[model samples]
Target: MAMPEYTDGVLELYEITNDESEDYPEERLKYTGLRIWYRELAVYDTTRAKLSADSVEVTYKLAIPQYKKINSKCICLIDGEQHEIYNIAHTTTKDGFKESELTLKTPAYEREVIDDTERTE
Candidate 1:
């Protein structure tokens, strides 16, 4: 079932901030708190020099909207799989980070279609 979109609902969705602020104070340099979905979370292994990690700790970049609760977990999708994330570590950059960076493995998929062209030869 799909929930109706809030037309008048005053619920503030979460979002992550990445743009650099010059006039804005450092403390107010937009931080990603909510509005982040899990599947959108990009996953990678933190390693010294290897590609994989024995234990994985995921990281997410999300946008936080002003006037919303800061303690809500967003549903994450990993390679078409769904996941729930309650706590997400926050990071900021000159250009905001995307939520697609917290998966155990990278996402990849493909589709196959049969050719329907008739051969004249």
Candidate 2:
């Protein structure tokens, strides 16, 4: 099968800053605006503690002049929201095309909002 057309979605990749001092140990993620051809699928569920969580699965196709490496330390920004990348699964390459399935976690604030909306409806 041919690769899916990714003209509709853009993948935003981020890098984690590791500038931490003895007194201040804080790491921040910087958005590089490096977009790629991709598609996202999300699933929302509640935990046993009644906490809401979202698992955002992204299918990203490899592009030329690769921007940044996709790893657990990276974050994906979709639709103006940030999702923490937890796992990256590489699929078998075909026709010189490579793709990866990224498992991302939704931010807490976004999850809360989704939970609230689900409750109201």
After superposition on all C-alphas, the RMSD of every candidate to the true structure, in Å, is: 20.9, 10.3
Error of 2 at 109 (Å): 7.5
Displacement of residue 26 (Cα, Å) in model 1 is 42
Model 2, residue 87: distance off in Å is: 1.2
Q: What is the TM-score of each candidate against the true structure?
A: 0.23, 0.58
> Against the true structure, whose TM-score is highest?
2
Error of 1 at 84 (Å): 4.0
Count of clashing residue pairs in every prediction: 26, 0
lDDT of each: 0.30, 0.52
Q: Pick the candidate with the highest lDDT.
A: 2
Q: In model 1, which regions exceed 4 Å deviation?
A: 1-45, 48-54, 57-73, 95-121
Question: Model 2, range 1-121, lDDT digits (tens) per residue?
Answer: 6755556566666666655654764556665556766655443333212322233343232332223367877666667677776566666446545567665665433321211122110
lDDT tens digits by residue: candidate 1, 1-121 = 3322223212112222333555652211122222332223333333422433533233333333222234323233323343334344444433544222222222122211112132111
How far out, in Å, is residue 97 in model 1?
9.2
